[model samples]
Target: MIRKLAIIGVGLIGGSMARALREEGVVQEIVGCGRSKPNLERAVELGVIDHYTHDIGEAVRGADLIVLAVPLGAMEATFRAMQDHLADDAVITDVGSVKGSVVEDAVKVFGEAPAFLVPGHPIAGTERSGVEASFPELFRNRRVILTPLDNTDPQALQKVEQAWRHCGADLSYMAVAHHDEVLAATSHLPHMLAYSLVDSLARMKENDEIFRYAAGGFRDFTRIASSNPVMWRDICLANREALGGMLKRFADELHGMADALEKDDAEGLLEIFERAKAARDRYIDGVE
Candidate 1:
């Protein structure tokens, strides 16, 4: 059990983690730190945290577990702010989508990725933001991937794993670079497509009419476009190399589809649609 849990950003993901751990009676106290006092107050009102502070040092002073849930762009600054104040035995972890960039930030701040620090990403979240949207069940049965360095402290890694398990998450481990690459393809690319498609249509001359006549498929496919833009922007920039490769590959596939359409290649189009349907069906079946 964690004696004291310090959450560096008390937004949706951070607040949800606190709620889950509190529900499991695994954390004695949760102290939230964020730039927004109103949000922190709301977190306190929602019982998501025991207390709140704007100072990173005050938040981590005696906490044994620290969760860096801030955006990827803010990671290095957050790390630099709290490093001097962190307890010697503190187990550090983050929920950043880009593991390699997070590891790089830690190295930049601490001269090396500390043994007690574990980089993690939970493969779950709605197109929602803020502490008010948080719930204890957000991570229930969801996959939480941890990318701990080879020299990471075993006890620290175990503690972080235990915390996520208490949140009802299914934990998995991978190398930092591999995690980034996989997430770029599966998660980041989809978000990019959703945002790009929505923006493209919204800027059209007949955007109002287009949206008014849109079907369920369009709404479902673009739901992620409603997600926090700043967070997604940071993620894309942090994992640019992998995400760029994915975007290029997708563009090539899209060009091929366009060519098929222009040539009236019904067989080619049907083949692509069938393959996609089969793959999606397999995924849905596996998850269900």
Candidate 2:
């Protein structure tokens, strides 16, 4: 069990994790650190964190596990702030969507990637933000991917894995580069498309009429557009290379689809749709 848990960004992911650990009785104390005092106070009032601090050094001073749940862009600064205050035996992990960027940040801050840092990403969340949206069940049955460096301490990695397991997460491991590429294709690309689609629609002359008559499918497809803009902005910039490659491939496919439509190639369109449907169906079946 963790003697003390420190979460740097006590918003949705961090707060939910604390609640889950508390529910499982795996953590003795959870102290949150964030810029917003009101939000931190709310986290305390909700019992998601036992205490809150605005200072990073104070938050992580004696913590057994430190979770950096801040945005990808903030990883470097957070690491720099807590490097000196962290206990030598404390296990550190992050929830950043872009593992490559996070690892880079660690390397820059510590002069090399620390052996105790285990880069992780939980493949679950709603399009919600802040501590108020957090819940203990957010990670139940979800996958948590850990991208440990070559020098990562085995004990540190195991502790992180066990903690996620206590929260009902299925654990998996990947190389840092592979993890970034996979997340870029599966998560980042989709969010980018969702936001682009919604923005495009909203900017049209008939935007009001279009939204007024929109159907459930439109809402479902653009639901991720409601996610926190700042977080996604950081993710996009952090994984720009991989995400850009995916975007280019998607753009080419869209052009092909458009070509098929313009040529009245019903067979080509049907084939594309059928393949996509089959792939999605298989994925759904496997996950469900």
Candidate 3:
């Protein structure tokens, strides 16, 4: 029943959401807002949005739902700009990977985390970005986590949940701190490792040969390294504390593996390998 849906950042995630909503006939009109005029124009041309504007206020006015799909770094400024322009009963949500910082910024800009302001993260995306890379089925069968504060309104939370459900997302709820910590390990740290591994290998003396000989495993493991740099940069910085803790644990495990290798402990290496394989198998089994 969204009369007008306004997306603040009309990139891949936002464009995908708009497309999903349009397919479901949940939104009557979609308005796109971004800093780049050309990008917005392209979004309109692709029919990802009904109209485009650089003015945040103009885009959000009369909109019942506003989705902030911008990078983590630009959230505070975007929230501040649109705070006063939002309709009285408008529901504000975001697709940001980090939740704690997003909640804090929302409180800072809106005086508190109102029930209508739900901090969310859709556990879905590909390495590609931009409006052209968007697809309506991107969220199908994917998990969407919503971290709603204590002061958040039940009705507002339900509305946001239903919207995601309409987009074919499975919904989960968690505390903001818990969400940040879990995402740090599952999403943020993995991306960091991918980027680091790729960068380190690319700087080797025989870099060309290394890449040329890389197999599917290497390509699959580092696929996320091709993600948007600025986006990951902001996420890593914003969740630095949690990500740092995860990195330390990861380093310790790596050291354990190194110790086993140095001692030629085949048993130890096999145990670690088997345990990892078991864990991954369990996850795949559950998901499938």
Model 1 has an lDDT value of 0.95
Q: For residues 1-288, could you state the per-residue lDDT of candidate 1 as single tens digits? A: 899999999989999999999999988999999999999999999999999999998999999999999999999999999988988889999999999999999999999989999999998888888999999999999999999999899999999999999999999999999999999988899999999999999999999999999999988888889999999999999999999999999999899989999999999999889998999998887876
Q: Give lDDT per model, in order.
A: 0.95, 0.94, 0.92
Off by over 4 Å in 3: 285-288
Candidate 2 whole-model C-alpha lDDT, 0 to 1: 0.94
RMSD in order of candidates: 0.9, 1.0, 1.2
After superposition on all CA atoms, how large is the RMSD of candidate 3?
Answer: 1.2
Sorted on TM-score, best first, the list reads 1, 2, 3
What TM-score quantifies how close candidate 3 is to the native fold?
0.97
Predicted structure with the largest lDDT when compared to the true one: 1
lDDT by residue for model 2 over 86-175, one digit each (tens)? 987889999999999998899999999999999999998899989999999999999999999999999999999999999999999999
Regarding TM-score, does 1 or 3 come out ahead? Answer: 1
> Which is better, 2 or 3, measured by TM-score?
2
lDDT of 2 at 252: 98
